[model samples]
Target chain A: MNTEKILLDHGSGGKISHALFADLILPLFDNPELSCQDDGAILDFEPGRLAFSTDSYVVDPIFFPGGNIGDLAVNGTINDIAMCGAVPKVISAGLILEEGFLLKDLKIILESMASGAKKAGVKIVTGDTKVVPKGKADKIFINTSGIGILPSGIHVSGNNAKPGDQIILSGTLADHGIAVLTAREGLSFESDIQTDSAALNTMTRQIIESGCDVHVFRDPTRGGLGTTLNEIAVQSKVGIKIYEPSLPIKGSVQGVCELLGFDPLYIANEGKLICFTSKQDAQKTLEIIQKNEFGKDAAIIGEVTHTDPGVVLLQTAIGGVRLVDMLTGEQLPRIC
Target chain B: MSLKYVEEFRDGALAKQIIKKILAVSKKPLRLMEVCGTHTTSIFRHGIRSVLPKNITLLSGPGCPVCVTAQKDIDTFIHLCKQDDVIITTFGDLIRVPGSGSTLGKEKAEGADVRVVYSVFDAVHIARENKDKQVIFCAVGFETTTPTIAAGILTAAAEHIRNFCIHPANKLTPPALAALMETDGIHIDGFILPGHVSVITGTHAYKDTFEKYQIPSVIAGFEPVDILNAILMLIEQNEHNTPGLQNAYPRAVSDLGNIKAQKITSQVFEPCDAVWRGIGSIPSSGMALKKEFHPFNATKKFNIQAIDTPEPAGCACGKILMGLKNPTQCALYKKKCTPMTPVGPCMVSSEGACAAFYRYN
Candidate 1:
């Protein structure tokens, strides 16, 4: 793994990725599920319906505040499947590591991934690893794919958003982005700000079982709430309007965003999700989410609108309307 | 919370009207130079140039502290970080600033004693705590930060903190502007003086440049409208052949500036020849610790020799900072030097023109 020269064979889906995995990753996390080699593993469970989902993780600084690529990989895929009112059953991981990656770091990352997967009650069944040269790729990039079983008569997607549905934010926005920025830029304050990276499968399960009619579920990850709502608005062909004052945000996150000229709404999140449910069921959903450890600060942020199809608008705190556009280019830190 | 109605200062409608008035009055192409890096960032961030008339071409000057800091001086600070019992305290932006081989952040990761301090006073506080160790405050910036560093020096001197020292890279803004005006490479039509620095040094500091170069200079605020208004003023001046210093940010800056800040700064430091990153050494452009305050000088305390260090082989940061070339004109801008992995000081500082262009533009 410490060899200077990187070769294309490292990324090849043959013996090189396997050797790199065995020599670097397996010894760190010698787990039963990860040891098994197959296209896909079957989960033995009494299920009403199977909720299958997959995702690829490609974040810079492979390691950041609160969590790293490993935990993010496991939690991200699990949260995606769990949003469908499902319990994550089995998970698969793929690694695209650079040749000069440290063996010790890979061990730590895998251990984190295993711990995260175990906590969610999801086993890593199948996996593949490939390594590119040092300059050809970043230090480490992990891709995770998972499958879960949905409960009976439960279905959730972006298209499920309906008029009069209340939009709820799990916790806060811009925590992950600020944490990453602070860590990367070496900016420190008297207040200790850490990334709120965690698996939300348990919280999602609690919301679903609380007898609330959740119309839609999505995690505001890469493009934040703006992009996520834009996707839902387009998918459902409905208008989404959120209140700026109602959105939950930490003071430190707001301060950093203001100084750095970054928009908190478009900043990234790791352990947060947006749920759309009926006004009648919104109270029940909020109550259930608030009771859970991960969703303690959950709040009803906004609601869906019937006008202006396939668009997201934010009514500012000062009583003005602004279009919440999907983030473009790189989300550079700004002093707003 | 004291709200100052900063929003009203960015009125786009008023700015558009002002722009229209300036364009109607202008006779030829005008080149306005924004001396503050913050102004440069604001100009691009708000797309101010797009709204301005085609006759007005905005040029970025050497207002960025990181961009103007000499490569050799940065290397010297990096060298100080290598010392066993020394702790290098500086702003967060200076940590990632490239020196000879690596940056302070990279060196800190590799076991160098580097700490990011928000204020110069924090460095003094650190020195008091670590009595046995040497605390070297990497003092970098213009008039805005000089007073704070001066105050820290006064505090350290009064406390008799033998361990506290400062690597002074504090440079004056007006002298550098004068140096730029003297250079044949740049042909700036007017000047947009730094707002924050003007709040400390006063508008009077630029009187010499205005008298000599006859360039209309405005001390403009950071807001979008402040920049737009300053551009309008420049265009008007160019049309009427009126070249003098103007103040667009009267709320913070005055003709004389903060007297207390200037008194402390003058009492603690003296003018000296300073080398700029993109620009050559300018006499009386930088500040040094006063002889009575020699105990607080890091260069004297450590007896560190000033080693001549060259820029990266093909880096055009010098030309970029002088407004002779844009960041994209540099061959290594996006390819070899990036925000994540920068090879020059301009790309490192958040307030730097290159960083602004790379991130916002």
Candidate 2:
């Protein structure tokens, strides 16, 4: 119990493995399904469509401002399910730990994961752990798979975006990306910016159940708003037009991005979503989203157009129009 | 947390007024070239091209260090990456730039030790930490980045870090401008000078080129308002037939520029004939490490040889850099070359004209 670092025996499936489960994971997760200590978790579900999602977290620096990989992994899968207009029910975690990783760090990560699941009202039903050599892996890597139930009356898809649909963005952009980049070694900067890695299931639920003509619910995660919009545009065979002045972004995040010669549109966002709804229902959906704590800065950013199908356009702040192409390759930091 | 300068320059109302002025004054078919890659990116990012009159065309010049880097130098970099016990540190902009055979990105994927550093000092730190490994910093930039590389060399020497070195691919901005003016069949009405480079070299650095050519020029910042204002000044100069150089970005650029930075740069590097990627060789356009700093020169210390690499077939990056051709004019532009599968440095470098045009237009 007082082991200072993880060891090979931690994954041996013997006494040490059992102790690690009981002493660390069990008390933290503290759920009946996981307490069974069996090969798999058993659960009951109503007859409905099930939305399942899986994601892996290998973000460098493992820890960053505002959140760490633990909560990021948890919330990532939850948001994926929620984006399908489903209520996240349960999640399974798989951990890959390095042998020399600090036990204290592991406990902190587990604590965050447990608390993140509790906040999202989802249970950590089952998980597996494996220990690798010290140099074989980073400190820790977590993979989470989640399942959610979709109600019968609610249906949403990226292909459902119509010509007269309006696009709504939840909160600000580029907070999570800038936060992680600054926290990285050899690139540290003095700033109070933090990752916006919060569970968006609550906000998604509010908009989904609001009786609006919702078309698409997407989280702009890795490629930011620009890539997500392109995906939706191509899927729906429509064109998108966004207003530059209407896009919400934190001042600190914007400053960092500008300094680094990065486009905020292509930067990553974690706790933000873009919704497509009929023009008449767009205002109602915006108000419903604004009622959530995570959607305070939400706004009607753009609209779907019938012309120029599969292209995304931006109405620049200076009243100019330009194409918004999907992000190509990785967004590298500029030289000057 | 308050980005005061950033907010002030990006004022939509100010940009609108300047744009309106530019629209009103622009009558003739004038082709203005922006000499800096950052300027090109700013113009595109703010949709400056869309706002301008159709008769007024903005041509991208050879200001991007990566886009202008010669094929031989890129080949030399890739060759150095293949050396044993060597760690190549470079700016992120140069990672995907293709040499004749391969790129630094491809070499890294093949298990080469290539690391991206934001500043030259980070490479020096890497060399200090890994004493057993020879860390070569790929120094590719203009006046805006050369002084920092000079400072990094100084830091390495003071600490006696012998393993740290840099491959000097630094270029001078003024010489390239003069070469552009001297080129035959090139018709440009005015020039929007680079703001960041001018911050170091000053408005005085371009005095010789301006006096000789009598071309209207304006140094501009990388903001919508700044670009629009610069465009308006160029239009006025052309219309009035009074060719002169103006400093539109006086907040960062002065007549004399940063004296200490210039001095430090001269202390470590000397002007040499450098071959530009799309353009041919130009005299005194490149900065080579001084004789005293030979030990810090990766090319000499590692005995690297430059290879003869030809430019891509049907690629107009060189013509594009000289403002003779646009990206769409190239046969390999969007069809065979893209940001994901770039056939030229103009498509690889984030600030390259092709990249800015591809992403924004």
Candidate 3:
């Protein structure tokens, strides 16, 4: 098989998928935990609460501004586990490769995945692979399931959000979406804009270690912070009120969104997350998050509310309230 | 904390006052045409249409470059994609724009050598690296994007990059608008001229259209207040029976426009007859690479044939773009031609009328 040319057999479940994984994937991401082939790997550690989470990545232009499918796959899962107020320890990868995908590209992706795992202090413990016909799938789609161990007395969940709980965003909104859109649109500006795709587990770990009693945690990926908050509101049966003025937005991303007729709030993001906690602990959480490199622009943007259950409302910079709902469909650029 | 001139222009108080004046002056069921895609988006984003009186209907026009690109042009670019040693680069918005049956995104997924690029410069850079492949920039947009392509062409010429070429589908705004007025089925009371395009071509260019149609034209910025003020200006003019050109985006656009950008565009391109998606053929509405710059023109370099193809049956994007129908009027709009699975030009182009309605409304 030519490493540069992808074939239909690669996506076939029997021989092609296994050979592709063993030859191209395993060598790049060679870790002891992943070597043991089982239904699921068993970890031996001291008694503590375990955090398990799963995520799927299907971003277009598979490779984008700051990162590609490899790092994105690892970071997404790690972030999910971290959101549970735990330190991510292990991950399992499942790949859905399209037939006729270049093996060289897959190798590059594996190397990125390995590096991302190293950065987030996590190990690839187990994995599975499947390949489909060229037309049956995108070039490559990855799903990652992660497991983490939380420290004693640390608990976090979406339903834990309470009234007057301060809402904090790690950094800017819509960076990942704009970066993806810019790359996808084939529109360029004078400044080079890259995706803010990175593992937020480190930042989350520091905040949890600060003993600020984080009530809830969520990484706003698809549907951005607005949709994520709306989901939390619905799940927790509470209201979320956000101040538009406090939302951190990069000037370039804002300009592109304005020019392309996109709302920053509705756009997708990958690297940022939201934390909801008590007002008293909010200051300490903000300070701890600010100390980290990724959380430099961390801000307390809003608070959870008891009014208007299951709704997310935004107070505009001009002091007007508007309902921020989950984006109904894919946001296409509109000339009007 | 500093509110720039553009920021102040969107003030709600000013917008409310302008809306009041527009309501007071206009007759019942006044139809105003917004001729820029940016204006349409701003109108929807700011919910300007909701705040206005029910009788005052703001109609979307052929201001979107993506919606106006003819099917033949898209087919020609898709044909270029069939070549093994060819890399077809274009803006993200153009990827899903339907040609006849399939889109560029679909073609790319089906193993076509297509890549989305942010700028023409990126295409040039790709050409610089892949000397064996022909890098064709799927050059689409109005005057707002023309200058960048012109600059890229100049750079490619100076750099002597043999692999780079442009499939120039770049159209001028005023000529298409003029064609709409001359054609049947258009009964517009006034015009809301596009702000960004005017910043490039200048507001003076619309003087002829205003004089010819006896309609008031206001080059307005993409803001709530700017659009409202334009409507008020148009209503005021209609009431007084005085038709002329006005500037509501005075901070950015002047009567003359950006002289440097215009000079660059002129140096690289010449006015040519172009096929608009909805409004048939319009003379001098399209820009083509000059004879001296023919080597960099993708159409000439690849001998691309312009084939006549019809839009998908029952798709009202063409009519919608021409201000003859609304998006909800289209049978396929919500059912088949959505943002994810676009089946028409209006659904495909990000700046298209149908796309705007689907996204905002």
Candidate 4:
């Protein structure tokens, strides 16, 4: 129990493996299905339509300010399924550890995953672990697969967007990308920013249950809001226009982006979501989202237009219009 | 936390007021060129072109250091990566720039020890940490970045970091402007000088060029209102037939500039004739390490000979940099060249006019 670090033997399926599951993993994610310690967990469910998703996390510097790769993996997969208008039920995790990774850090990560699953009202039913030699991988990586049940008479898709649909962003942008970049060694900066990684299933589920004409529910992750909106606009064959003044951005995030000469719209956001709905329900949905803990800064930022199909335009604060194109490649810090 | 400077300049009302004044004073068609990559990016990001009067045409100039980097210098960096126990360090902007046959990025992917660093000091640190390997920093930039590199070399010398060296491809702004004016068939009515460079060399740096060329020039900050205000100043100067060097960004720049930093740059480097990518050679426009500090010169230490590398055929980057042609006028823009398979440095560098045009237009 006092082992300071993981070794190759941790994945040998011997006493070390069992202790890793018992002393660290089991105490945090205490559940009967995981307690069985079998190859798979037996599940019972009623016959209904189901949704499934799987994703892997190999984030550098596995630990960040607000959260780490563990909870990010869980919340990412859960939100993926929830954005489909389904209630995420069960999840599985797979861990790949480097030989020299600290077991104490592993415990912290597992506890984070547990808390995230607990808040989302889901269970981590089963998982597998494997350890690689030093230099074979980064410190740690996680993969999560999730399943959710779709309720009757509920459907949401990117293609469901229509002209006159309003776009509602969940909250402030660019916190997670800036946090991760600044935390990296040799790039440290004095700032109070932190990663915004969290589960968005609760609010998304409420919106679906509110009987609103919700067209699309998307979490803008890697490419941020600009690329996400472009995807929806293309899929729906409609034009989109965003008001630059209405974008919910924290002053600190804006300052960092400006200093780095980066566009806040193209930066990543871990916890923010973009909801596309009819104009009539945009205010109601915005008010509903503001009620959730993660959606306090939500606002209706843009709307779908009929002209210039598949193009996203931005109306600048000074009354100029330009195309908000999809992000072509990775955004990097400028030398200036 | 207040970001007072950013908020004040980004004011929508102030931006509108500047545009209104510009619209009122602008009578004749004017050809204005923004002479900084950061300005190019800011203009596009703010949608400045969309709101400008049709009579005023904004053209991107040779302000991007990456775009102006000599083709031969890039090829030399790629060749140095092939040397034994040599690790090439560079800024992110120079990584993907294509030379004659390869880039540092391709060399790294092929197992060369090429590392990206935010500053020259990081390369010095890497050399200090790894005594067995020689760390060569690719020093590519304009006046705004030269002083810091010079300071890093001084730090390396004081600490006796013998394993660190620099491949200097540094350029000057005023000489390039003078070169552009001397070029035949290049017509630029006014120039929006670079703000960051002006902050270092000060407003007096452009006095000689301004007096000789009699060109209307304004050094403005990199904000929406700042740029619009500069445009209005240029229009008024042109309308009244009065040409002068005006510092629209007076908050940071002064007549003398930061004297201590200027002295630091002079102590480590000397002016040399440097070759620009499409513009050929501009005399006394580039900086090289002083003879006393020749040990810090990667080219001298590695015994690498400078070989001229030819630019891509039919590439209009040269004409674009001089504002003689637009990026759309290029035969290969968006056809054979793009941000993804870029054949020219203009297409690759983030602040390149071709890139801004492709992304914004």
Best by lDDT: 2
- Candidate 1's residue-wise lDDT over B127-159, tens digit each? 998999999998888988899899998888888
Backbone clash numbers for all candidates listed:
7, 1, 17, 0
**Residue lDDT tens for model 4, A197-261:** 98999999889888888989999998989999999889999999999889999898888887776
Off by over 4 Å in 1: A1-336, B1-3, B11-27
Stretches off by above 4 angstroms in model 4 are A1-3
Model 1: chain B TM-score vs. truth?
0.96
Tell me, by DockQ, which candidate is best.
2
Displacement of residue A312 (Cα, Å) in model 1 is 16
RMSD of 1: 10.6
Docking class of 1: incorrect
lDDT per residue, candidate 1, A203-291, as tens digits?
88887888789989888988888888999999999999898667888877776765665678788888998999999999889988888
TM-score of chain A of each: 0.88, 0.98, 0.92, 0.97
Models sorted by lDDT, best on top: 2, 4, 3, 1
Rank by DockQ (best first) = 2, 4, 3, 1
Give the per-residue lDDT of model 3 (tens digit) for B126-210: 9999999999998888898899999999999999999999998899988887888887868888889898999998988888877
User: Per-residue error at A93 for model 4, in Å?
Assistant: 0.3
Compared with the true structure, what per-residue lDDT tens digits does model 2 show for residues A161-226? 999999999899999999999999999699999999989999888877778889899999998999
Give the higher-TM-score candidate: 3 or 4. 4
Put down candidate 4 lDDT per residue, B222-259, tens digits, no spaces. 98999999999999999999998999999988988888
lDDT, model 3, position A4 = 69
**Considering lDDT, which of the candidate structures 1 and 4 is the better prediction for this target?**
4
lDDT of 1 at A119: 79
Q: Model 4 - which docking category?
A: medium
Higher-ranked by lDDT: 2 or 4: 2
- Evaluate residue B235 in candidate 2 and report its C-alpha lDDT on the 0 to 100 scale: 92
